[model samples]
Target: MVSISNSVKTGITTGTLRRVHHIALNVQDMQASRHFYGTILGLHELKGEEVPKTLIELVAAGKVANFVTPDGTVIDLFGEPELAPPDPDPKRGFTRANHLAFDIAPELFEQAVEVLRENQILIDHGPVTRPTGRGIYFYDPDGFMIEIRCDPMD
Candidate 1:
């Protein structure tokens, strides 16, 4: 058997890396992606000059779109021509669990669902139950799978 250690002797301490600081994604359109994540998803968009200093280089001097979740998770969307589009087949849907999951407050779950409906966004899988919580799945305009999980199911 093999064992791994991080007690400083093996190099990095447990605090070496904190929680996920950000997630970068490639998208089809800057404006649409910004609208979806900023407006529909209700994340705060970091408009010009408001983008974080540390992210400037990677953000490509206003070329990328930046949004922040209420919990401070940063989302960076890069608008580039697609190398390939999301699979259009049901059998390839799960595709080995390729998806991004976001958390929503249980109290606001119904409102969120309503918002999705109002926007005419299709719900691919849920509002389904699990021992852990209730979740809804869908796809972003670029075909990335997205999951919204509302815990403490009533």
Candidate 2:
């Protein structure tokens, strides 16, 4: 049997990376996509600026999409829709693996559902239980799957 040193045992810390800085996603239309994330999702528009001929960036801050429960996170919406992979099988429905997962406070589930329904957006699944806990799946205007989840352990 091999023995490990105390220093080696202490090296592995129980922690995660501080927080997600930003998630960049390609959208068919920058303006409409920004509206979906900012207006519909209730994320505040932090910045929406164009950078020359290359791309446009739309940043937002909010809770449902935040790094902290109420501290807000930065979501960078990119303008180059052509950059994302094309769905080879359009008839197969949304098969792209690219997505963003967000942590939603348990209390906000109802408001989230109402907001989504009011926006005429279709939900893929429910505020039901996973091993992780209750969650809901939905899509953005750009067909990017977004998940609102609550960790059971939390």
lDDT of 1 by residue, 4-112 (tens): 6665456568898988898888777777778889888988988659788877775675468899888888888987855355665532563445888889889887788
Per residue, candidate 2 scores C-alpha lDDT tens digits across 1-154 of 7797776644545575676555655566776776787777767655334222232321332211211124555665656646443564322355446457777777776788788888987677786787867777888876677777776745
Clashing pairs in 1: none
Per-prediction TM-score: 0.79, 0.62
lDDT of every predicted structure (CA atoms): 0.78, 0.61
In candidate 2, clashing pairs total 0
Q: Any residue pairs clashing in model 2, and if so which?
A: none
Runs off by more than 4 Å, candidate 2: 1-17, 48-72, 81-85, 88-98, 151-154
